[model samples]
Target: MFRGLGPEIEHRGEIVVIGLGRFGSSLSRTLVDMGHEVMGVDLDSANVQAHAGVLTHVAEADTTNEQVLRQLGVAEATTVAVCIGADIEASVLTAVALSDLGVPNIWAKAMTEPHGRILSRVGAHNVVFPEAEMGQRVAHLITGGVLEYVALDEDFVLAEMTAPASLVGVPLGESNLRRDHRVTIVCHKPDSGRFTHTDRDTVLSPQDLIVIAGRRKDVDSFGPSRR
Candidate 1:
């Protein structure tokens, strides 16, 4: 993701993550596993100590303090992610401090739409709502036919769903999905086998999972009735 940073930057330069909650901790650990230097920070001493051995560096500090951030060299990191979703004040203050310190990349977690807007206004390069996104995914999964759903954006989605009874044994070419539902089948996975590229001639079975992409509304309407 930081490929645009170029090779001039030292390889050992770290990615600093503040607020060692579930999202922050998981992101730090994943970056470490991917062989990148990571520094995890939190106001809670226990959170910092919990990840001491797992992360490259662990620090306990109030990230909203510009002095503390500067002392920790937060501005020198390749990127900084502010993960204090529950505390809007801290999240916004931390982002502002990072921006003032000239951190090139700043990501933040927001608890609500208004919070996200505030974070962006305060110089967060990216704002993510993990809880809201997960809620949408789980809602789709529980909607009967949908096996999985991924939101590509606010309006578009990629979904995998069971072949509806109406579509069972029908050749893909005759389904008229593109014309009627405004969706395109990307692939199909049988219950017992790997996914295969789908073509017009491919026939869907009741047990098969069809991966489709289109507008969120269209994709939702393409599948069978929910249980």
Candidate 2:
């Protein structure tokens, strides 16, 4: 899958995405684009019908209801994303319900620091504040180089790129990227996130994605290693 869910992800048994809001809708789109079979569940039949073509299955039900989720085959899903926005209650409830169902991974949405803290306390695998994080990402992208930076911590950020034409034929250890770009080369991806390219030794072809990290501004200014 595009996000490096790994090669085994193609064996996707099933996937249930709860809530048909903008966030959930977009995520389902991206997952489908990644060539995975996804099921979108929501309380609104109209919303569920809207994504019927995009997802393998569309179920209109309250995901927070354990029985409804079970009927939707959520327990078999390797991952479930709860994208209820504003209604943190629904989001938290859905995450908790999914966890109880033995879903391998449960992702919840949070609107604030307190919400994140609470969601983390509830046993959710992860809490996402997408809008805020995306704003920061777009802001950094507009600044250039680190167009889609995602912070991993207070001090570390993950960035993306089309391998800088300058650093075409270089390998990691010899690149000294940390000293020059103030970022660490985490992984290399060829042609977007379509596949992991372990052969960093292969001269970088155009549009290879370099996943890197460093301090906020430093990572933002960091470009592909200069030849």
Candidate 3:
């Protein structure tokens, strides 16, 4: 039976990853690095061999078959990600199998909107477009002076950038950043220190790193060139 079908997927749990292609492989590796137990399944023997030493358990199996997935212990998994690439048919089928097995917290990768819709309908709790998201992230980094950019949603973003000249030497409370720029500095880190929560009294140094959260346009405009 499906269990713990919560709104959010916990990072620490037993996860079954189908497909050992680039996306699947990378995901499995990261999960293992995070100290999670991972069972990686792939149809390709080469892929299975490549990750045999890394994953807690890896097998070459036809994940499109419900019995095969169940035999691989996918049915009992708390979380599973269908990361099959290119072969949309296989991806959908694998997702269907996972759903039939009643595994909770199914995550899937979709290459297109239609494919994503199908995955969602077939019981994928979350469908992600990795390529499209990455392209958007890279575009933001190339355009703005931000050292890092994360789009929390379509409109809101969190950006990390160096403290501009205008912000240096001024306590955040005295600056009209929120009213004028419509962005809030979440935290700041000095050249030699770790990041810490920011407050109204927090003053910025010329080399301090600041993470700001706001609307995308506002965050992009709050860069070093902004006055």
TM-score of 1: 0.88
Alpha-carbon lDDT of model 3 = 0.86
Give candidate 3's total backbone clashes.
0
lDDT of 3 at 160: 88
Worst 10 residues of 1 by lDDT: 1-10
Choose the strongest candidate by TM-score. 3
Task: Point to the candidate with the largest lDDT.
Answer: 3
The lDDT for every candidate, in the order shown, is 0.84, 0.73, 0.86
**Model 1 RMSD in angstroms:** 4.0
The sequence of per-residue lDDT tens digits that candidate 3 reaches over residues 1-227 is: 01112378664467888889999999999999988889899899999999998999989999899998877778888889999999999999999988899877899998987898888898888888888778777887787677888877668889888898888998999999999999999999998999999998999998899999999889877774553
lDDT of 1 by residue, 72-186 (tens): 9897776898999588899999999998998877888889988888888888877788888899899878866778888877788899877777667888899887888898989
Order the candidate numbers by TM-score, best to worst. Answer: 3, 1, 2
Error of 1 at 129 (Å): 0.7
**Alpha-carbon shift of residue 155 in model 1 (angstroms):** 1.0
| Residues forming the 10-long window of minimal summed lDDT in candidate 2 | 1-10
Candidate numbers sorted by lDDT from highest down: 3, 1, 2
